[model samples]
Target: MLKILPAKEIYLQGNEHAVLLLHSFTSHTRDMKKVATSLHAQGYTCYAPLYRGHGHTPEQLLHYQVDDWWQDVVDAHQFLLNEGYQKISVIGLSIGGIFTLKLAQFEKLSQIIVLSVPIDKEPAQLKQRIIDYAYNYKTIEGKSASQISQEMEPFHHMALDAMSAFQQFIQATMQQLDRITVPIAIYYGERDDASYAQSAETIYQHVHSSTKQKRGFENAKHLMTLGRDQDEIIQEIIDFLE
Candidate 1:
C-alpha cells in the first residue's frame, strides 16, 4: 500500500506574542512551516491554519468562497486570543496576503506582513486563466504536467466559481487597504511570477500605516519564504516583530 501523506496544521506555543502565517491559494500550511519555525525559534508562538477546502484537493477549493478562507483566519486569530495572546501579528502569502489585509480591517493586529500579494491584478484575466486551466488541465507555467499533477494530486481541479470568488475577494481587499492602520511590511521579488514588486510598493504607499516598510529581493521569486533569501527574510521578519 502507498503511504498517504497527511496535511496537518502547524502550531508552536511560545511567548505571549503570536504570529499567524497563512499559505497561498491551493497550498497547505506546509508552505508557511519555515516561517513558523523561525518565529518559534525567536520565542514567538506561531500558528498556520489549513483553510477550508484546502489541504485535501485543489478541486475542493472551487467549493469554497473567499469568505470561507477569511473565516479561517478569523478563527485562527480567535484561537490565539482565547489562548491569552494579546499581541498578535500576521504574515500571509499570495491569496493569504489578501486575507491578511482583509483581516486588518476587522482586527486590531500588531502588524501585517504581505508576501507576493497582487495589488495590480486584472481580475477578469485571472479568472479566465483559471477557467482555461480547469478546462484543459494544462501544465503549470513553470512545471511539467507530471510535476504539476504530483504537486496537486491531493487537490482537485480549480473551478470557475472559485475564481470568481477570488476576484471578489481581491476587489473587497483593495477597497479596505486604506483602512489598515497597523504597521505594515511587504515583501516582494523583482521577478515574481505572480505579482510585481510594484504591487508591494503600491501597498506601502497606500495603506494608512504610518510605520510601513517595503523590501524587494532581486534574485527571489514569488515564493520568497522558500527562496535564496529565506534566512534573510526570516531574520527581517523577526526583527520587525521584535
Candidate 2:
C-alpha cells in the first residue's frame, strides 16, 4: 500500500490578518499545508479548505461540477468573515487561482496571490490531465494494473459535458479579470508548460489592480508551492503580503 493519507482542512489562528489558501484541481488541502504553516508562523491566520469534490476518489470528484466547487470557495470566504476578520487576503493555486479571481470580482479582498493559474483559455490537455489524475489516484488506492485499467475504462470515453463546463468556467473568469482591482501578485514556474507563462502575463495585463506583479520561479514547476523553490516562494509571498 502507498499509505496515502486522508486530506483535511487546515485552520491556524494567529493575528487579525486572515489568509484564505486554496488548492488546485484534483488536489487536497495538504498541498497547501507548508504555505499555510509558514504564513501562520508569520502571525497570519490561515485557512485551507478542501473543496467539495476533492480529497476523495476521482469518480467521486467527477460527480461535482465547477459551480459546486465555487460554492465551497464562497463558503470558505464567508467562514473567515464570520470569524470577525476584517482583513482577508487570498492565496490560490491552479484552479484555486481561478476561484480567487472570481471572488475578487465580487468581494473586497485585502490582496490576492495566484500561482500557476491558467488564464488565457481552457488548456488543451485538460481532459488528458483528468485521465492521468484518475489513473494515478487509482494506483494510490492500491488497485492492480488490470483493476485500474478496468476501472478507468469509463473515463477514457467519459462525457465532455464536464470538461465543457470547466472550459466555460475558465472563459467566464477570464472575461471578468478586469473587474479585479485589489493588489495582486502572480507567480508561475518557468519549468512548467509554456502556457502558464502566457497565463501569468495575460492576468497581469488584464487585471485592473493598481498594484500588481508577476514573477517566474526558475526552478519551480506547475506545483510551485511544493516545488524546490517553495521556501523562496513563501518568502516572496510574505514580502508581498507585508
Q: Provide C-alpha RMSD values for all models, in order.
A: 4.6, 1.4
Model 2: lDDT to the true structure: 0.91
Model 2 per-residue lDDT tens digits across residues 121-187: 4444666777888999888788899999999987788677777788899889999999999999999
Error of 2 at 110 (Å): 0.2
Give a tens-digit lDDT track for model 1, residues 1-242.
22325478899999989999999766678879999998998899999999887765335555676678888889999999999999999999988898899899889999999999986455556555444444344342345666766656433444455556678778778877899999988998776864557778778877999999999878778777888888888888888887
For TM-score, the strongest prediction is 2
**C-alpha RMSD of candidate 2:** 1.4
Instruction: Give lDDT: candidate 2, residue 194.
Output: 95
* TM-scores, each model vs. reference: 0.84, 0.96
The TM-score, computed over Cα atoms with residue i paired to residue i, of candidate 1 is 0.84
Model 2 weakest 10-residue run by lDDT = 119-128
lDDT over C-alpha atoms for residue 140 of model 1: 27
Q: What are the lDDT figures for the candidates, one per model?
A: 0.79, 0.91
